[model samples]
Target: MSDTQNMLNDFRWIMDVVQNIDVGLVLLDKNFNIQMWNSFMQNHSATLAEEAIGQLLFNLFPEIDEQWFRRKTQSVYILKNSAFTTWEQRPYLFRFENYRPITGKAEFMYQNSTFIPIQGLNGEIGSICIIIYDVTEQAINNLELEKANNQLEIISKTDGLTGLLNRKSWENLLETEFQREAR
Candidate 1:
């Protein structure tokens, strides 16, 4: 094949991978207009790429706090550095429904997203690419573990039969009171 054919084939492969990847990829211009929306986004949001492209990001997903998003992206544009947000910081940008069977307990999908600055040919930041990873399973598991730990702590401190403080707990409380009084 010719060199042009090889380059064309490489481009096709790259596009295929981007579209089929499990994570959501959204490319937006400086004005926050959607430029690219991959298949993962389409599946979760039920919004086709054709419909999403050229639309304002805030308009399509009104749930997204426009002010908050602008603040987050501003730094990326100015510094040309990547920014990250974990599920703990903010649950999700798009309120996508949780459809995975294992994470059914979660009502909405938890996301860890990255804001990447895309530089143009002139070496100026022109667009931002947001990558969204579904982290529902990890978030739910952490929440459940926390709940279990709280229950275990309560059980250890309280009497099983009477639902009152155990001897050890009472003794610790007495010691704390004594120390405070001494002070």
Candidate 2:
């Protein structure tokens, strides 16, 4: 293949989609330094793939907690699964929905992020692939939308005004909260 086409094929996978995805993808070394940052990542993170390559995790964005660094490094090097704090735990780490204050632009919103270990030629993990899928429009906005009657047990006997246990819910709530506080 020609150099131009080869370079294009290196990341032509994005062209398959009709309406471009807000999602971003990044390939990171075991140390968590960026190895590959797709166009989406560049547009969203406000940093180009070429510019951020070879930098350390701590140096990329200080908002990323030390705990995340320790866990990510361990997972890439040792083949372990690590969870990320998205909306609830650590909102700043994702930085998808909002733009960098310095740049003043929001790229995209990704609700889910997964880190996978990439194996080297020796079959040992040599890097980590960070795949970020933008699901904000589906997850946050459509949360209550998919709610089905079958999902929740219908409380025919409950009071309509409060949607609370006429008596059963009150008992359960009181019992659970009291027990929690007691402990």
Best by lDDT: 1
> lDDT at 145 for candidate 1?
99
In model 1, residue pairs whose N, Cα or C atoms come closer than 3 Å (at least 3 residues apart or on different chains), thus clashing, are: none
- Judged by TM-score, which candidate is best? 1
- The parts of candidate 2 lying over 4 Å away from their true place are 1-22, 80-92, 97-110, 142-183
User: CA lDDT of 171 in candidate 2?
Assistant: 84
Model 2 CA RMSD to the hidden true structure, in angstroms? 8.2
Residue-level lDDT of model 2, residues 98-170, one tens digit each, is 5445543324453567677777899887887766776554554444454544345445437778765577677
Q: What TM-score would every model get versus the actual structure?
A: 0.95, 0.57
Clashes (candidate 2): 0
Q: Tens digit of lDDT per residue, candidate 1, span 56-167?
A: 9999999999999999999999999999999998999899987877739899999999999999989999999999999988999999999999999999999999999999
Off by over 4 Å in 1: 101-103
